[model samples]
Target: MADTEEMFLRAKHRTFSGLTEGSCPSTRSCGATAERLAERLAERLTEWLTEWLAEQQAERLTERLGERQAEQLTEWLAERLAEWLAERLAEWLTERLAERLAEWLTERLAEPLRDPEEAERQWTGPFCFIQAADPQLGLMKAWRIGDAVGGGDEWEEEVALTKQAVAGVNQLRPRPRFMVLCGDLVHAMPGTEFREAQERDLKEALSGTDPSIPLVFVSGNHDLDQVPTPSTVEQYCRAWGDDYFSFWVGGVLCLVLNSQLYFNGSACPQQKEAQEAWLEAQLSRASSAEPKPKHILVFQHIPLYVKSPDEQDEYFNLPQEARQSLMERFKRAGVTAVFSGHYHRNAGGCQDGLDMVVTSAIGCQLGDDTHGVRLVAVTADAVVHRYFSLEQLGQRGVNEELRKMLQAC
Candidate 1:
């Protein structure tokens, strides 16, 4: 382990020798690697740039340029050169990390498991939907509120909560054929530790539950960086399978859009266009199908409309343009309701023509709020939803903490 650690440290330090001028910490393996890569890349670019600048300076010096004029020219050239180099380095690092992580993860996740197709054989349902959010796998201990002892060291709390939620769906006596995770699977950033914890939590959570249960996962902003990239979406897709995609549940055509769509302007055009086209195709297909869906349901991470803690920011809100596009698309598709989360508190109603649901977070709650999952039953006629608190299910410790939090809120 020491030798392995040394190699990574050496790589990072050697790679970034001139640029960062900072020492690499041996403790964090991933950080060491990132630092090393950044260092070396910057060093090489800086050297090449210095040479180019020297040539430019020589050319200027040979000319009749004054001192101040030469200095300004040099400065401008250096700034533009450094900016270009930094952009390239950032892009390279992002691509390298994304590719390495994706490949490594794909191999690990490819471990043999019971086939999803095999499990589908036994499923029978009017197809009820189980709604839940904020499974906060790695941060179970961080959910404490005031005097309540809510933190658990083990990742099992998240797994247990998920299992119970799944069991609730399974034992619906009649059984719901599908389940939806509102968002926020891991409480922290999607780094190495969080990824591993998420894998373990997901495996444990889905264990022994009906493998046939179609899970629809929508990405919360936390799931990816503020400016989400294709690689971010790739990571989520690889980990969760095609759970992010849309499909039919009973007679309703459901559109599950990655809510990360709201952020990162550059990444939006393609995603927005693709989703619009996909929705159009799906809507067209549904309309021409033998049995057209009576309703359309959209699942997203942040609610389109929410009661804000602050009026200025609009607490529970969706991006205006994206939200408008979504609203129009769903309306065109005949959508009836939109399910969302991120408030960690519950308050939802109709916004525009669609009923918007601001689901309570299961990981933690604010001010007398319930740590629960919302259960929604939709039919050809109407939609009904119920909040099923884990506390009500006899998880008193969680309930107490959440109650205190809600009261404070």
Candidate 2:
């Protein structure tokens, strides 16, 4: 019985030891050395944890980086688009406005006041016109002070005279067709003091004239600057109509010249050349026109000659070379008369079928002639003219002889 019990106990011991050896425990009671077993378990746990953490963190980091990049790119594009739109809009508006203004100014200068296609060139009948000059507004005061170049501050005396002249023109029996003031509209030079005021007062005085009579303005030395540039000439045109223009009344072709151009063209040679070309065309065309003018006349502020065609050059007359050339041109063109008034007195003569009429001033005179205007009669036969003082013309009218001549047409 002892030997059988010993065999069973040995069997039980072997079975139990096999079970403990095969089992793995996480505690220090394991069969292997405790330190080595613990080290191997810790190494396996650390490897698993590191691999799991890497998967989760890498996914989140990729998602966050992608979202931030998209947001920043969207913001950058939006800001660039807004800046470009603002810059383009301003450039477009400024360019369009400048083009429109230039077109308007060009149209206004070409047409001026008259319409030739509307038959203003047609002949109605024989008529008479009044020619006058130098209603120089501030001249009286300037002459009194012995300094006409400086101009005067006051113009009351000349203003009164201009009003009287207008009143006299209104009192005529058969009213004059038009009144031409041959130049020196004011004593003040351009850019001088009292220029605007003098022009204003003179215009106010002449406004009293009858509306039937149009006023023809001629530019004088005072109206043009002493040495005229392109800028000065443009300024003069703006103030007193065109510096030079032509018109017709009762089949008479009247050519008004800017004599200042011929006098001094050093500053504006182009302007001088243009006027010469225009005058040449005008004279050549009028000489052989289809309808034909009753008589061709020339009006200007400065005379080709003050007294005689062959006279020498002076302040009051055109240069001798210009005078001869113009006289030859006028004779060729059948121009019957040339009227002017910078001499401040009546001093001109007729030579070789051309009548040079230099009418006196209506303002301060530099000579012995009284302040007056000229009455010009146009007929199928001949052109006739007579100078009369303001008092004589206003009170007496044209005498019966002159009245008969005007009605003869």
Candidate 3:
């Protein structure tokens, strides 16, 4: 027993050491590899270009100028042309690659909830929708081993949990009008190992969802960069859907926000500004339009404040300044409840009339809360919601409560 314990400790030490001393992390190496490849392409392209220019223009240049002058002009032109070509080629390649990957994600995920125009946005009656977050397809095991990063080489647990959640929602007696995954669709960051596989597997697990229930998505910090860039946002839009959007269900206006912008828009100010403008426009129109919405609900990845609007800023909640401004706007605009998921635990409170409801994760738990999802039932008077473990989601009691809520419409 003593010998076995010693061997296990040594093996664990080696694993930790290997990560620190390992070759370049996949995220960094991916960027470096693209840069180097572009450099080589530019070098080869320069050679080919110079030869072509020299051959094609040599006779004409000699006829017009001295041989020496013509030769110098040709060299100058080749250098300038090569530099321009390289810049354009590199830019094109990055955009194209991100686009193709996004296409791949969309092809598998099959989410069609982006277009608000194609769907119903009118006040109907009362209904229910599932609001869950942080399926984070690879975080369960990683968190267990205390190596959240670089330890997500496998994500079977997340896969099972996601499927379980899907099945739970599907079995509801009164099916949810739609389901929104608040963010962190996968634990693997945008450019790390197992990211693609996790995304693909997640999509496959979600594919079993009933066609009648549309799947809505919100962008999480893990979904893009903690401080996202234009490139990452664009990539996210391509792979998922619009980072922010609006839709109406049973007369309620639902806004899916990209909280990453409000979190850290330093890298992408223009995007942040654009979202702000769009949001104001959305709020203004929704509040004043004919037959005003039954209620305005917001969906985002990070809660405005886990407990109170005056709470100190932390990693789990939005910064105080942004939070105050946005929350006030939401309150003025008649936003009822702001649904979010990032704390990996349930925390939030009603501020004045606004409710900042934070749901626990469906994949991993950072605290005592069991893995679960939030069910939100919308009525003409209020937006009622509850959290239930996956096992409890389909229970008769839960179903009866949901039925009662919808019947109140």
Which of candidates 2 and 3 reaches a greater TM-score?
A: 3
Off by over 4 Å in 1: 1-127, 143-154, 284-289, 308-316, 391-409
Task: Rank candidates, TM-score, best first.
Answer: 3, 2, 1
Better model by TM-score: candidate 1 vs candidate 3: 3
RMSD of 3: 19.8
Question: Per-residue lDDT of 191-250 in model 2, one digit per residue for the tens?
Answer: 888888897778778777765566777888888876678887886776666776677666
Q: What would you estimate as the lDDT of candidate 1?
A: 0.59
Backbone-clash count (model 3): 1
Model 1 Cα shift for residue 22 (angstroms):
58
Output the TM-score of candidate 2: 0.70
Off by over 4 Å in 2: 1-118, 399-401, 407-409
- Per-prediction TM-score: 0.59, 0.70, 0.70
Global lDDT of each model? 0.59, 0.73, 0.78
